[model samples]
Target: MTEFDEILKLEIEARKKIEQAEKKAERIKQEGIKQAEEVLSQVQKEVEDYRKEKQIELEENIANLKQELETNFKLRVEKIRGVFEHNKERLKSIIYSVLGFN
Candidate 1:
């Protein structure tokens, strides 16, 4: 065969190799994109779960605070009622003195 024919054959073979490399690169790119999408989906699910957990925790804390407030208010009201009963006689005497209702 002539040198020119040999060179032409080499050029064609090189072109075929380059095409195969491009196809392989395209396949790898698609695979990478699919993997990234899967990871993103998983991360989104994890974030949703974390949000639900935090919401439940917050609700529990709010309930606890409300119960504590109610308990404290009841205790304070009882103490005030006791003081009023203890001062009832003095309060009556003061009222009569002020209005001259003795």
Candidate 2:
């Protein structure tokens, strides 16, 4: 073959290799993008689940606190009742003694 024909054949082969390499690189880039999107989706789902769990825990804690407050109020009311009853008896005895009714 002439030198010109040989040169032309080599140029064609080089262009074919370059095209194949470009296609392979494009496929690798697409795959990387797909994997990154999947990871981001998983992380977002996990964050949402964590938020829901914490919200439930906070609600339960609030309910427990309200129950404790109600119990404390009831105990305080009973103590106040006892004190008032004792005061009434003491007042009655003092009045009887002062008026000579003892």
Candidate 3:
């Protein structure tokens, strides 16, 4: 073959090799993107699960606090009632004397 024909054949082979390399690169890039998406999806799910767990824990804590506060309030009210009952007779006597009806 002439030098020109040999050069043309070499050029054609080079083009074919370049095309194959480009195809391989594109496949690798697509696989990388797919793997990254999967990782992102898994992370999102894990974050959601963690958030839900924290929320439930917070709710339980709030419920316990509310219950404790209610119990304390009831105890305070009972103490106030006891105090008033113990002083009710004295209060009545004082009122009667103040009105000049002693």
Candidate 4:
């Protein structure tokens, strides 16, 4: 073969090798991007799940606090009613005594 032909052949082979290396590098980069996306998706899902769980827990806590407040209010009302009834009875007795009915 001529020297020019040999050089041309070498140049062609080098170009093929360079193309192959570029294709390999592109494939590796795509795979890395795919893995990173998957990891991000998983993390996002986990964060959403955690947020939902915390919201549920907060709702439960709020419900329990409301129940406690309601119970305390009812107890306070009962005590007030008892005191009012007692005072009313005493006033009745005093009126009866003053009227000479007792």
Per-residue lDDT of 12-101 in model 2, one digit per residue for the tens? 999999999999999999999999999999999999999999999999999999999999999999999999989989999999999999
Q: What is the lDDT for 65 in model 1?
A: 100
lDDT of each structure?
0.98, 0.98, 0.98, 1.00
Q: Where does model 3 exceed 4 Å of error?
A: 89-102
Q: Each model's TM-score?
A: 0.81, 0.82, 0.83, 0.85
Candidate 4 residue runs with Cα over 4 Å from true position: 100-102
TM-score of 2: 0.82
Best by lDDT: 4
* Superior by TM-score: candidate 1 or candidate 2: 2
For residue 56, model 3's alpha carbon misses the true position, in angstroms, by 0.5
lDDT of 4 by residue, 68-93 (tens): 99999999999999999999999999
In terms of TM-score, the best-performing candidate is: 4
Displacement of residue 46 (Cα, Å) in model 1 is: 0.5
After superposing candidate 1 on the true structure, give the runs of residues whose Cα lies further than 4 Å from its correct spot: 89-102
Over the full model, what C-alpha lDDT does candidate 1 score relative to the true structure? Answer: 0.98
The digit string of per-residue lDDT tens for model 1 on 7-59 reads 99999999999999999999999999999999999999999999999999999
